[model samples]
Target: MIHSTININNNNGNNDNNNNNNNNEIEEINTLDSLSNALKSHITFQILKDTFNEYSKLIKYGNFVSLKHITTGKYLTTDDKKYLTGSRGQIVFSTDALPEANAIWKINYPFGSQPKANNEIVSYGDTISLQNKLGKMLWAYPNYKSPTSGHVEVSCYSMNQYNNWMIEPNISNISTKKNSNEEKRYLKSEDKIVIWCIELVEH
Candidate 1:
């Protein structure tokens, strides 16, 4: 359901089998792995789905998505906070009322798989990377100095464990009489149902 564009340039082997041959041009292969990796480095902007769509498609591997701070109504922004004068940058929620270019992020699944559908919401596994448009990743550094200490920052994409984050829907904004725990679980399961329906339709 979620359509993502992935550009893969695979240079496996050249046409010439012998080393002396200059015409051994490398062939380009398109595979899931190549697509996934390409998606990581090539995602430049936000890829939002149509609001009118009934079911939310599971975000494909390497697709760009925006993270909206539920309470602030602001999107996650990159390079808003700088720890050092010339340091890479830090991640912060934008103060602007509307989403901006810096707020766009690419969801990176280091394990190489698509985000699973939980109810209508897409669930990234235990850990995922939120890579900003600037090619830096959102990182949370704890045990550091003040302000920057225990705060989110952006660093060069290194597939670091600290950069991994668990993304979940903000249930606090959901208005319901049900208990918080119950509501969260219900919503997740409901999303699963929506995903199942979409699967059925595809089949």
Candidate 2:
């Protein structure tokens, strides 16, 4: 479920203390009402939307599974990177143990301009894109793997040539030291990449 439900229960006090217990119950009800009203504010909705959107986005383009190449149909082990295109729905794998997928998971990346060094040449809302880029890069591996244990450096480039670097807003990078088995060796056919839900195979 997207959210958990809240529950409240009432308790009856002893006969000798019935009056006092009733007063306590009233106070509890007032507190609950205040909390409910506070949660109804627009700010609350925005926070919920933003959090859900980030999670949805992460799951979409971030399914790091035992992917089977469309052309070669070969299976890859961990630490491999394959340049993928099309929605996540279009990609299929041979093994089971896949992470949960979502329909609205879109791969968000900045491709406007960037630099060779790890410095920011352009700023788009202060590290939001950087966080987003890092999230996408995290998908290069399964959740069972360790992130802090090793070094993962992702850098952005201009285009398929890997020569001309894009400006700040436009960011692209490669996942270093991937256990990638099959490499497409070509850029995706479409300009934008998307992730969608597909059938899972449990092995």
Candidate 3:
């Protein structure tokens, strides 16, 4: 299981116009620790395992079981996985890859700066194999820095249903990694990047 932590703060919108607005309660933000715990509690690792299984199948047999290309509405699985090269190569996946299968959780590196909500950058464009899983898509987004935290979101989709009628039930998992000065630059301070995951569930 994976988990995360977060902090809650009061909304900063206090004005005279809506003085009587009773819905001004502060929003709850998960701390790094809280985010981590939540993901673990939800059995997120199991979800990833399933996604990878499905992804691998497409590569092996050539098919699209979920989302369309948003343009082609057709199945598309590139053969790049077989002959992957240097860094930032074409999209690919391998069972023996890092953040191993059923990887419980993984932290991303080289991720710099945190963007406001709705500003999630593509961390990794990879695939998973989830032959028969309950959940849709489950992903984790590590914090950009320490004390700030990271997040994870999950969603579900169906191939038999209408193309645009997919339902997404997502949960963000945020966790912060603590490090020391002597550790490697990437390992020393876990504040330069954010790690996130996506789990496509079948309903």
Q: Rank the candidates by TM-score, best first.
A: 1, 2, 3
Count of clashing pairs, candidate 1: 6
Instruction: Write candidate 3's Cα lDDT for 1-203 as tens digits.
Output: 33333333345666556774433434343476655554555656669877665433221111113322233333212222222222221222212222212222221111232323321221212222222122222222122111211222122222211111111222232222246743211111111112222222211
Worst 10 residues of 2 by lDDT: 185-194
| Model 3 TM-score relative to the real fold | 0.15
Off by more than 4 A, model 3: 1-65, 76-80, 88-201
Question: 96-201 in candidate 1: lDDT tens per residue?
Answer: 5434446666656644545564223334233566665666666655544334434434344435445766544433332123465654221221222211211111
What is the TM-score of each predicted model, taking all chains together? Answer: 0.43, 0.20, 0.15
Q: For model 3, what is the C-alpha lDDT against the true structure?
A: 0.27
Q: What's the C-alpha lDDT at position 189 in model 1?
A: 19
The deviation in Å at residue 182 for candidate 1 is 18
Clashing pairs in 1: 15-24, 16-24, 119-190, 119-191, 119-192, 120-191
RMSD of each: 20.5, 18.1, 22.0
Task: Give one digit per residue, the lDDT tens place, for model 2 in 39-124.
Answer: 55547677997776443322112222223333444432222233242212112223333333311111223334453333211222
Error of 1 at 47 (Å): 25
